[model samples]
Target: MATETFLASFGLVGLRLIERHGIDPAHFARELGIPSTALPDARTRLPSALLDSAFEKAARCIPDPAFALGAAECWHPSHLGTLGYAWLSSGSLRTALKRMARYTKTLGQRMSSRCVETPEGLQFIYDHGRGDTLTGWVMADFGLSLIVSLCRTNDGTDLAPALVTLRRPTPATIRPYEDFFGGPVRFGETHDGLLLSWQVADRPLPTSNRELATTCDAILASELATLQNDDLESRCRAHLLHELTSGEPSDTRLAESLGLSTRTLQRKLAALGLSYRGLLEKTRYELALRYLDDPKKSVTEITFLLGFSEQSAFTRAFKRWNGKAPSDYRQSPGS
Candidate 1:
């Protein structure tokens, strides 16, 4: 379930990168013979074939081979507007990273951070999950970007690590890797991890906000609730949510997609106290709120982004569910 959720979140950021590169993703999707509009919702499990094709296409479109890694760095929450601001306002770097690891699903995946005290010092291990072979280079670059971001976030460009470990073996680019990490870089290690001086870990935080931290924790809990159930209902919800933004989400299609009979799928949903339509609507609603909160996106864009027919249709449905128009709800002071 964590894998599915993580994949979906990573896909969202991947889509953002595709758009940021000035590539017509819709056209690219169509060229690949997949529905371009349905991409946002199809995050649950991308067919390996399609994912490879898209990745290849993106590589060709971007002039910089390191585009994916660069995008990951620039889009980090600590650099983004509201999320970054909230992180910088946290009690300490530890607290900031905790908040980030907790709510990072709201942004992307393939990356996570955890802290542990070691006999020598403190370790902050950054883990990135699987991707294509080319992703190895991207991951290496991303790891470097992370170090840079961490130092910049703390306003200390002089930050250096005692030891840096990478999962991949040594390559021709080893020199750049050494330069970035500013220490010996070990390859073919048991894990891709980093070690920080204990002093840095214990340093007092530059920003502290108890109220904001509380709010962030609460939001993470709420998001986790949706993934709590290990029953048929939860599976159905997960499946549908991962596929909805792509098209007219259907129980039959979902069943077929999962290699199950339609009748069996219906039986499963029934056992979970839900139906196909109910789960689909629930998924759409959750994602709608997330997209609507972004001031950078317009209502029309949200409509297409969520796979709705039109702005009016999305508005009408949003009103039916929330008892207020989307724009008004988004603009409300407390919202």
Candidate 2:
């Protein structure tokens, strides 16, 4: 499937949110030739064009001008699949955001985003890849609001940004945007994203779980690697290099991302003379040793980078691999 488009369930969930406002979502879906999925599974992807139509209809149906902001308020992680879990388990807002930019295909596939570190703060550049600004504000608003929500959830604060920008035309007054975002918002701007402070992005999350995050990253990476029919091991390893920080992914999740069932993935791995767990361990070890070689990064940091739950856990595993702690190995000039 093409990258950046949302899953079927995301479309379905948007309908439900519309319905909550007493708008018949099915009518709009049917009117636009957007098929409504009976199931809530986030597997099928519809083009961004269809979603843009949905947003337009949703705006028409709702009398409220801030419907997009409200739609994002209704969003839950389930609407995003493993991307939600990965965001939830991120070590910090900055790390989570980098992961989001890296795996945008699995989440908001049509929304282009980047986190740029500036002297003042982090400026997140975001834009709807295929929609005109006239009706694109809904998608843009929903995306920006969701990013704000994710940041708040990670740092557990009011988490206001330094500045916010939108691609939509200027409203009658800026009060609604400011009131909603808790910051000054610029309409008719060049971009559609937030400018946040370094203090907010650098703050660590209480729910940080390196191992679990690595698993999520594995799914995230595989979702973006759908162009070729390369060897499963090579493809898997290549994806692993990008995703291992999210944590070890489940067999079913990884299999689905690879466009196969668990049995099929296992069979292919077996054909290649490999098992999923074995490959995962080997990848982790390789990453661990590589990270350990750099004395500047503490083992605590390396532990999270390798997706270990904690430093002590990484230490125990490193000892098993090299018969010495990571600190000892880092100190040793060589035997």
The candidate that achieves the highest TM-score relative to the unseen native structure:
2
- Measured with C-alpha atoms, the lDDT of residue 183 in candidate 1 is 77
TM-score of each prediction: 0.50, 0.67
Query: Which candidate number has the best lDDT?
Result: 2
Q: What are the per-residue Cα lDDT tens digits for candidate 1 across 62-108?
A: 77654664443445442332345556555545445555555444433
Clashing pairs in model 1? 38-246, 41-242, 41-245
Alpha-carbon lDDT, every model:
0.59, 0.73
Tens-digit lDDT track of model 2 for 125-188: 7776755555677778777887888888877888888999887888776676787789888887
Model 1 residue-pair collision total: 3
**Cα RMSD (Å) per model?**
14.5, 10.7
